[model samples]
Target: MKASAGSSSMLSHIAYFAIIILLISFVPAERLGNAEEALILIGFLGAWRYSWASVNFARAIYFRRFAYPREKERAVKDYASRPGAAHAYFLTTSYKIEPEVTIPVYTSVFTAAAKSKGGATIVSSVVDGADERLIRQVFSCMPCDMSGVKLIIDRIPGTGKRDALAKALSLISRNCPSSSDVVVFVDGDSCVPANIVDQAAPFFTNPQVGALTTDEAVDIPQPGFFRDWFKLRFDQRQIMMCSMGLSKRVLTLTGRMSVFRADLATNPDFIKLIRSDFIDHWRLGRVNFLTGDDKSTWYWLLKNGYEMVYLPDVRSVSMETQPKPTFFGSAIALMVRWFGNMLRTNGRALEIPSRRIGLFVWWSIFDQNLSIWTTLAGPLSAITAAIFFDPIVLPAYFAWVMFTRYMFCAMISLFRGHWFPVSYPFLLYFGQLVGAAVKSFVYFRLDRQKWTRQAAKGGQKAPRSTSERLKSYGSIYLHVLALGWLSLAVLYLTGAA
Candidate 1:
């Protein structure tokens, strides 16, 4: 009966949100002409914003109360290891363009790995339906002396998006040989630092260390308002969440770059977890729950008492491309998928005997959901507040909210030793408004289950040429100018300026 009550509550919550969204669509703008309508709008928006702020404050307090006591002794001990043999694995799942910038980075990584008495392996897992020419291009970019570094490209049978990644990991686990001690996973586009092995090697000394992830710096400067805003907001959030140790439950270990023990990779159960078809089946309504590859791996390791370490020193640089038109759509889809997956994994975590894992699961859900809700409420609150209050004050209030949120984000970035970009606060505000609007649309459509390949935000095609990239940047400039004009027009029309 208790379980039934909880299920009913969840269903009701979904239904309430659905009804609110539907009502919003039907609300005539003309109806909001009167003071009463304005008051109603103010009440709605104010309540939502306050709720969001309250939640954020609550989470901040909770994190402070349960802050993981950083073990300085353990940190010191982990840093004391002599640089031993290192192994770098350039893991590529897509049959796409041979990344020119990445090749030199890989060469440097391998040289460093070899000097550290470590070996290197290049693993490529090809999707069966991907272009053959693309696969050949990837092969052409690799060094010819395939002896010291093994190259394996397996054609997986499935059309699933993650199938290629699973196949690559499987091949690495099986063919890389037991002699290889460390398995560093780097995506095709990721540039590795020369000192990556030196920074990451110390973590392996601890038996509990199953995996390690490093900080990623966005390579290209953000071109336009949208791209700059998103990059700033995203980078700041990642810094905060990572510093809070939230990445321990990270589902996608960032195909950008990370390192793991070869033994962990070789585990049959780990491979099975990564390749699970649970999500596909669940999306078809065949199952109530699903789990993704990376999440499953973390779950398995935690269940079996293995610890995942994060090293801020081992850094990777990734070139930032313009956001595609489908970028927001893809983000919403991914978040919805993760919401369902987290529910299932958190359930499993609850059943486990360890208190630490249970705590991690609880905090992970709280952190992610609360952050998303806060972002959504930002624009909703601003629009709603405009209805009841003098329109002139709306922009100031909205600006305040944006600055407050950005300040928190900037603090996180600073704590991580990164310079907070001057343009970040404005970009964060714009990005939040756009993201909230897109997510609201997706939520109402109830089509979150469908999978769509993401396009570049500026509507540039993949494998963008230099000229195309330049054009996309120009488009961004035009967009910001248009938005500025629109904002001024709205202010004038509303008699708010």
Candidate 2:
């Protein structure tokens, strides 16, 4: 697949350059007016995406290079000198993750718990006795002073993460953590630094800050579609996260690893929201949340006017697996779930006052709603211009896409992903174009929900009736049709079509 995509890109570059050479050599300046007009439209539409990405990449650099280091220095110093620091609770839920992955994950938790010094708790919510035994064995093998560490195991029916986490939160609240104590939520397949508690707990020393999520790097079993795709996506996530962190707020408290004040984590209202989150959509009507427990946590913090921090320097390793070995199927499945969660929560999040969340944060949420249509404008404009204006518009648009997308991949190489990914340009374009369409599909039918990784609890929705299915199909078609009309109308008014 990589070879095929590389070959296709090479052929496209050759064709694009050849056309440019032929046109510049033989075509008269006056006669090239149509192509010039079409090229202007393409560039104008592309400016939106390029500008957004450039600003975000720059903000991320500022956060990582200049801003976060000072915050870390202060936090670390304050932590080292403090006498009576609070407890650290490492709470993780394992449903059916493999033992190979789960072992190191729990080992890291045990190690961190021992490092906390002021006594810590490890809450593991598992389904079976075998898993409980496996966790105990892993805990026993830890080479550290675990006398200060206490392990609590909860047996849960393998329902989903929401239920498991809510149960664990209830258990922690029972212990009644002190004002300064913190709870760390770790996924069963993630390994945190042994000093994660020491590093993150200090940030909570500030009374205004409520939660924080750190940077993540992937640990793949082997190289394949999964590794590259995950890297590309994480690179994007890293940039956006750092950008948001500069605001003293992040979009989502990633479930892979997030730290919250024990007081807020113990709040019954907070735990209840995660367990039973629902949005009353105008069309869909009271859509229940199945996945996206992370979004729920973030929303609770944001609405309550609590400051959330992002620690770019502190990192965790995610042990990722192929949801479906095939790249297309797995990538699409994830985009659906991921975007569905964002689309569901972002609207309600937007309802919060700008004064409450800050102006930039408010506008960023607004952009999330606007970007879906804006992302489609460039391609749809190229098509409209080609039909109504000139055929050469097609080649100009194709050449522009090849140049711009590759430029984007190159620029982001400063962050996480590989510097020289063979098919990155194509993959980036595929993700954007197809991802936009998927967002549109899910936007209209918000009731459609699933988890790509958890096979047992995936697709929790009941079967739809025939008439209900037709209504969904009709809603999606009309929304798409409206988008097409809007794009055409814009291009025509601009005299590009």
Candidate 3:
């Protein structure tokens, strides 16, 4: 069956390519020149957005055969039993996290910490310490005695995640001074597995490894389009992260959970970076970043030449609940915050010395800035060409999209231990179109954002200052004008306008 599916996938790819070639070859000579130009331009735009991910996808497929079982698991166990196994400390931050999610997340981490030779400390941050008290209650109910672990509930003044994390990091750094100690950052809604420590902590034995992150899967008890959508995102995330791990560099140390050497996490400089990291935008000037603390940490490690590792064997399950009732609204809210973080930090992350980041990693960072436009380019260009040149163009483009995305989904599921869902194609288009739109909005409105998960009463200042609001409005219209001009030019030059 596996061989049959693989063969069918290959045949589909061949058929798709053949159709594209036929379409290009059969155009009339008079129209051929314009068609060829349009094809070249469309092809390049498509490949520009896809080529790097394809390369990473290929690398991931290659690494899976040897790396899947993760030979390092036994080594991790041996390392943990060793006399001086690094002391483990956890910094978990919460803001309005549901009780069901928070309880299991703490239970898993604390249960694992109890078995460790070294004691662990949990510095949990909460809004009113109400949930923090609930955490203490949950810790007390652990099936086994957790004498080795201690909990410190830190109540923040209703600030955002950055402040909560900053407070936790500062407290841990002061308390756990040893360079050998390892501090793991966990989200209140993330449920880690029992062997997470045994699998993750051993990597720190390598003195140069500044941080380690694990693979994460999402759990959505109530099933629907949103649930399926979240699952697909995690699936793609797994593939991309595993690919980066092969090179010992990851795009981001996901905020869901990541482990860092105590020295790095505790450094006053690192804390300051997390608290107030920002980049000097050409138009915006020193734009203070409000989100993506994980990116800030990852950039600091990269710039400083600290090696980061991704442990695919250690899986964490994040409990995902849609904040808004409607899927579209909820997804947009999430994307604005997410893309805002990525764009705000893109400038500096790319500037890290090339030699330190390597060619592929550097190109990936550069592509993040370009992809928003490139991914959106195809649809917009195809629509314009179809309206002016030929109606067949749109149908052909849609066919290509369905075929290619289906194959891409199949390939991603090759190493995954589960079946790929049928809803993936829909989710893929949604992500491309909707995600791109959100990125474009945040690209210009860099200073405009808020924590989507935070309560409205948190009383954080609004981002609608007169100057900022005007700039955001101007930026949106300016981009629209530019896009309109570009589309018309493409159509005219290709004889389609």
Candidate 4:
């Protein structure tokens, strides 16, 4: 199956590139007049940006393929057979999690830890009383004796995830004595495979590796628009992380599930950083992070010169639940949180010396901010060309979108269970435009947001008075006006107005 999918992905790439070359060659010479020429050039620039991203994505998928380890049973046996092997600890946090999702996640962790040769510890920071009992019940129901494992359930004050995680880290530091122990963090709504320890333990053999993150598959059994969208996000994540893993620098140690060395995770400074980490924005001053706790942890590791790995074979299935009833509403809400997290941390991550991190990873970090605009260039430029240059330009651009994105969707299919959906082309554009717009809004209004799922404000910024609120509105108006004028200027300069 792997071979078949790989071959299909290769053909998709080849066909896409070939189609692009053919389309360019077939353009009518008459359309190359001066006015039409400039508009076409701008449209092609957008196409070029799209082409570069598509190529990089393909390369990333290839690099990720080599990161998955073989002979998994032997690796697990070798790691476990050693005397005085590292003890493994599982730390997870939850808020308003359903019994069905919370129970299976903890159960799987208990089952996996019970089978390991060394002792294990499970720490859960939970908000709901019922979730705590259900998790304890999972521990009690374990078939094997958990004589060596300890279970500590810290009931948080419903402050937020950051607080819950901080509480758990404090508990672990006081109780866990060994710096060499392996600490695995999983979300409340995620289930780890039973062989998780066996798969991840062997990687710690390389002392340079400070942390490891695993591949994920979302469990959204019910059919709906959100289900397919959730799967697509995971699929893209696998390819991107795989590519980034080849360079030994994954952008984020996914909060869904990641393994870290106890020394780094429980360090006094690391714990404090995770609890109150804030970035100094040029305009916003010190902005405390409200979400993206995973990113905070990741940035800490990168700054300290720790190598991070992506284990493609180690799978953690996350439960997918839509917070909003409408697909568009849910997508926007999620992106606001997700992209807001990225934009907030992006500044500090970029400042880390490239010598410590590689050039590829550094450039990739920079690209996140630029991608918002580049991703939208195609539609925006094509529309401008259609309005002013030639109607044929729009038709040609649509043709390219159909052919290239369909092939891109085909390549993505290699990583998913179901074939790529017909709606993917539309969904692709929706995610691109909507995600970029949300990223822009959050970039400016970094202080004005909340964790929609958790029902918590992302920052503790004090409320502004009426006059201050009006000033903010004025700033937004000027920014929007400036952008509109800039667009018109560019169109006129390019002879497309």
* Clash list (residue pairs), candidate 1: 86-118, 323-456, 323-457, 324-455, 324-456, 324-457, 325-456, 325-457
Q: Model 2, stretches more than 4 Å misplaced? A: 1-32, 35-38, 416-418, 455-467, 470-474, 490-497
Q: Candidate 1: misplaced stretches above 4 Å?
A: 1-90, 98-116, 127-148, 153-161, 175-180, 246-252, 279-284, 287-292, 323-354, 358-361, 374-393, 409-413, 416-422, 433-497
TM-score ranking from best candidate downward: 2, 3, 4, 1
Local error of candidate 2 at residue 416 (angstroms): 4.5
For candidate 2, the lDDT comes to: 0.82
Give lDDT tens digits, candidate 1, residues 168-230: 767776665442366676654566776666566655666766776666776645455545544
**Top-lDDT structure, candidate number:** 2
Model 4, range 265-287, lDDT digits (tens) per residue? 88988888889988776655567
Q: For each candidate, give its TM-score against the true structure.
A: 0.62, 0.90, 0.88, 0.87
Superior by lDDT: candidate 1 or candidate 4: 4
Q: On a 0 to 100 scale, what is the lDDT of residue 294 in model 4?
A: 91
Error of 4 at 39 (Å): 5.6
What is the TM-score (0 to 1) of candidate 2?
0.90
The parts of candidate 3 lying over 4 Å away from their true place are: 1-36, 47-50, 67-82, 456-466
Instruction: Report lDDT (CA) for all predictions.
Output: 0.52, 0.82, 0.77, 0.76
Error of 2 at 262 (Å): 0.8
- 1 versus 2: better TM-score goes to: 2
Question: Residue by residue across 326-440, what tens digits does model 3's lDDT show?
Answer: 9999999899888888887777777776788787788777887778777777787777666666656665677668767877777777767775656677688889888987887
Pairs with backbone N, CA or C atoms under 3 Å apart (clashes), candidate 3:
none
